[model samples]
Target: MSENEHSCYRCGDDLPGHARAWDYLLPDPVALLSDEEQDRLIGVRTEQVVTASGVGNFIRVILPVPLDTGHTATFGVWLCVTSRPEWQAVIGAARAGGETWSGYTFSGRLATAVAPWPEVFGARATAVAPGPGLVAQIRRSDERRLARVLTQVWPDSEILAARERGHVPGVMTGDRPRWRDWWRRGRRKTH
Candidate 1:
C-alpha cells in the first residue's frame, strides 16, 4: 500500500480508487414501541434488562432513541467501485472481528455473532474506526437495495430519513448527518 492508499478500518485491505464513502442512519434493533410492540418486534430474541438509572430508558430502546417517529435512522455506506469479488469476503473478515451492534449493557452479555453497520470517518466523529465498527459496502447500482435491506431488518421502526449523506465538521454526530456539510467542505477549499 502506498501513502495515498487508504485501508479499511476493519479489513486493512487497500481501498480501491474511486471509492465514495457515505453515511446513513437507521433505527436501533429496538425502537420506541410499547412493551407489547417490542415483544411483537423482536419476540424471543432478547431478555429483560436492569439499569442503574432507576430503569434506563435506553434499554431495548430504538437507536437515536426517544423514538423519533419523524426521523429516519442513519447509517454510513461506502461505494467501492471495484469488480474484485473478493472484497466482500475481506469485508466479512473485518466485520467478524468488529463491533457493529451496540448497547450490550441493555442487550445482555452472552456475546453474539457480529454484523456490520454504517459509520463515519474524516471530519466530525468517527464510528468503527474509533475502535472496530461495521459499515456496508456495495456497488453503486445497489444503493436502493441496501436501503430496503436496512429497513427490512427492523420491521417496527418508523423511518422518515434514509439516503446517502456526507458528514460535516463539528456537526456530524452519530445522531446527525448534515448533507450540506459535504458542500461546505468544498466551499472552504475554494475560499
Candidate 2:
C-alpha cells in the first residue's frame, strides 16, 4: 500500500487495495427498545461503537449518559472512540482473527466475547479509504445475548465485573487519545 492511502483508525493495516466498495451497517440506538420513538434515550443501551473494515481494528465508543444514573441496570453498553494507532491495530487484528470481544484486564475480559456481537446483530461496520466513518449501535437484545454467551466463555467473576463496569475496560483511563499528545509534542519541538 502506498503511504498516501489512508488506514483504519482502530487498525493500522492498509484498507486492502483501495477505498472503493466498502460495506457498513450501523445499528440504530433504539432498535432494541420496545418503543423506538421515545424522546428520552437514557441508560447504557444508548451507545455507539465505531470500527473499521478488514484486518485488525479497534472500536471507538461513545456514551450518551450522564456520569451518574439513578439506578444500575442488569447490564450496560458503552461507546468508545480512540485516536490511538495502537488500539486501532489491536481491535482490527482481533476482528480479523475472529476474536470480537475484549477487556482491559483478565478480570474484565469482555472484549473477546463482545467482538462477535457486532457481526451477529447485523451491526458489523466497515469503512474503505475516502469513505464515511462507521458506527455500531448495540441494543438490549444484543447485550442479553452477549451476556448469556459470556457466562459460558469466561469466568463468572470476569463476566460480572464487566457488567458492573458497563462491559468496557480501561474505559475511564486516559482523558484523550495519544495522537493528541504526539501532536502537542511535535508542535512544541517545532516552536
What are the per-residue Cα lDDT tens digits for candidate 2 across 41-119?
Answer: 3222212333322111223332111112222122233222223554555446435432233322101112222322332
Candidate with top lDDT is: 2
Q: Listing every candidate in turn, what is its Cα RMSD in Å to the true structure after a full C-alpha superposition? A: 19.5, 19.9
Taking all chains together, each candidate's TM-score versus the true structure is 0.19, 0.19
lDDT of each: 0.27, 0.29
Off by over 4 Å in 2: 1-48, 51-76, 98-191
lDDT, candidate 1, equals 0.27
Once model 1 is optimally superposed onto the true structure by TM-score, how far is the C-alpha of residue 187 displaced, in angstroms? Answer: 28
Q: How accurate locally is residue 146 in candidate 1, as Cα lDDT from 0 to 100?
A: 31
